[model samples]
Target: MDISAEKLKQLRLERGLSQDLLAKQSGLSLRTIQRLEQAGGGSPESLLALSASLNVSPQALRHSSVPTISHWSFAQRSVQLSALLLLLALLLALVSLASHGQFSIYLDLVSLLFLLLFVPGVTLVAAGPMGLIMSIINLSLLWQHATGSLAERRFLQQLYQLQYRLCYGSALVLSLLGLVSVFYHSPHLSTASLQGALGVLCLGWLYAACAAELLLRPVLFKLNVSIQAEQHTLAN
Candidate 1:
């Protein structure tokens, strides 16, 4: 009630509850509760849960007033972005293996389909609901490419809008050229070509990861909404 995370956490412990249990009772994710108790970004539902689980009144929570930040910082975002990068690297490695022996016409078609679908699918999973808007298209392009429905124009348009679009483009074009060279001229999976392409893709991925980490970070708190009433002293 004093706007101290330790106080709230203390109350939870006194009630013989773990953070996870407290979060469950309050209809919050464990992560959200952790953030709230850590004095970080979390859903407003945390306040509601505190009131319900602790049997405290809303007024008690509101009594301290909410803290406000004019800007979000990078202290916590780096952690999450590192996770994203790890996931991307894992997916790339898996895709390269899966699409290995499937480079013939029909194999290429199937492999492409798998790449297009699987990559995004895993990303969507790893990123969860939050990454939908920003990452959906990138995943989709890879999906379409795998299915052999790859459209160069769509990629061009999509690339134009991304923040690191040029970097991605540079990387993508080089990969494409490498892939074409390896596929048409050689038979087996092109290790050199794949590595080169992966290099470029990695660059693009880094660009995206950095951008995500630095931009639109979550910092939930309160806003100051003030009202002013004007008085009229006309012939009263």
Candidate 2:
């Protein structure tokens, strides 16, 4: 917010320190420290790093410039807020597309797109496609998610993330099999091959879904993980 803080932010960014990395080293939450940089008020620990590592003063860090998002930025919360907005945009876009569209061959493309959006792709796998009404409900739930606190939001995020991943995964597998089926020769189509492909695909989707749910057990409450979040217990 201030000139000095802006400069400090710029310097921090130039050093290539992530908010998480900085927080890990400085004993603070990534969010809180990020808020400081945005507010042009980094922690004393951050200041120490800046002064010692960057040869700047705490006063200078405060009055330097706006603490930016990266090693080059320390000026404004550009990197931090931009990342937040980026994820928000990506999630909203996915939700929007999934909510009010037909599951055509195009959706396979969308699923592939979703896979590319996240790292270590193909996390969630869903077999049943959501109908129009279900899509509305899902989008509505996602929009309402914005009003909650961090923990609440994290849960919703986990839910949607897993949901999309599953859908994408299912779509991916189905698309591949569909490709395989179309590739070779099949004038009338054999019962055995069809059954085998269909069976294997179903089992794969089911297994992926269970595994994703189990892996993200904390964010996703299966059988109500008994998390004392807010004031009530949650059920997945």
Candidate 3:
């Protein structure tokens, strides 16, 4: 009876037991469970103990199937698009700063302040808890990306989708607010301040549009591929 590691891990999960709890239940050391789960080799005695603890026949844990990687069609497109947009934005910001001299510094500082205060609040209000969770997941995926270990295609697809949703949602809310501000402001305010507010609003909308079209739409388009795959599987 040779059980594969994947099968053993799946059985353990089906029993709703953590590795530590399964270890305790089977009278096996935690390290033993971990090793078995990772390497798929254990003595007959250990196998019997785990089987007994999981209430399964030892044969059920054997002969695990190989894991399949998802084929994410949008991953490369999303990465390339985001990189291009980021590069362009950086170049434009730098050029504008250089052209404006000291005044650009003041504008940049003010823009940063506005962004810091507005982006998070609007994202939170619009996306709520789901957005927060997705943002955390995105951050995790980004870390994986940075480390060159983001191998899960499904996860990458999800990260791109969530990022687009966040960007589009924030952009829509901010654009609406800007429109309202334009109409409701008191006549006493200086034209320069009004122009500044409009500039900030336009900047936010521009960023959102670029993100949605360049970085997000490609990911959205790839979603259909996943749907078709599922349908094909079902048809078979």
Instruction: Tell how far residue 74 is off in model 2, in angstroms.
Output: 46
Give the range of the ten consecutive residues with the poorest summed lDDT in model 2. 227-236
C-alpha root-mean-square deviation, each candidate: 19.5, 16.9, 11.9
Taking the tens digit of each residue's C-alpha lDDT, what string does model 2 give over 1-236?
Answer: 13244664577688787767666765667775666666654434556654665665556655433222243224223433544475576557667776777323123343344334432332223322333223224344312212334464455555556554655466466657655864464555587866654554444444344334433332233112212222231110
Candidate 1 Cα misplacement greater than 4 A, ranges: 1-3, 40-42, 62-236
Error of 3 at 115 (Å): 6.0
- lDDT tens digits, residue span 1-236, model 1: 22346667777787899988987888878886787677633334556667788897745544254343223224334434554576687567657766886322122232343334444454456445544344444334321221211243333333323323333444355457656765675665477866654444344344443333332111100000100000011111
Which regions of candidate 2 are displaced past 4 Å? 1-119, 122-184, 217-219, 222-228, 231-236
- Which residue window of length 10 is worst by lDDT in model 3? 141-150
Clashing pairs in 1: 112-146, 112-147, 113-146, 113-147, 116-142, 116-143
Best-matching candidate per lDDT: 3
Question: Global lDDT of each model?
Answer: 0.45, 0.46, 0.62
RMSD (Cα, Å) of model 1: 19.5
lDDT of 3 by residue, 1-236 (tens): 24578988988888788999999999999998898888775676787898899999877766654223256436645665675677697678778778878435333343344444454565567567666455445544321322222244454455556566666666667668777878688475689988777776666655665556654555445444444454353332
Candidate 3 Cα outliers beyond 4 Å, as residue runs: 1-89, 92-96, 99-131, 139-169, 175-186, 189-196, 210-231
Decide which is better by lDDT, 1 or 3: 3
Return the clash pairs for model 3, or none.
Answer: none
Candidate 2 RMSD computed on C-alpha atoms after optimal superposition onto the true structure: 16.9
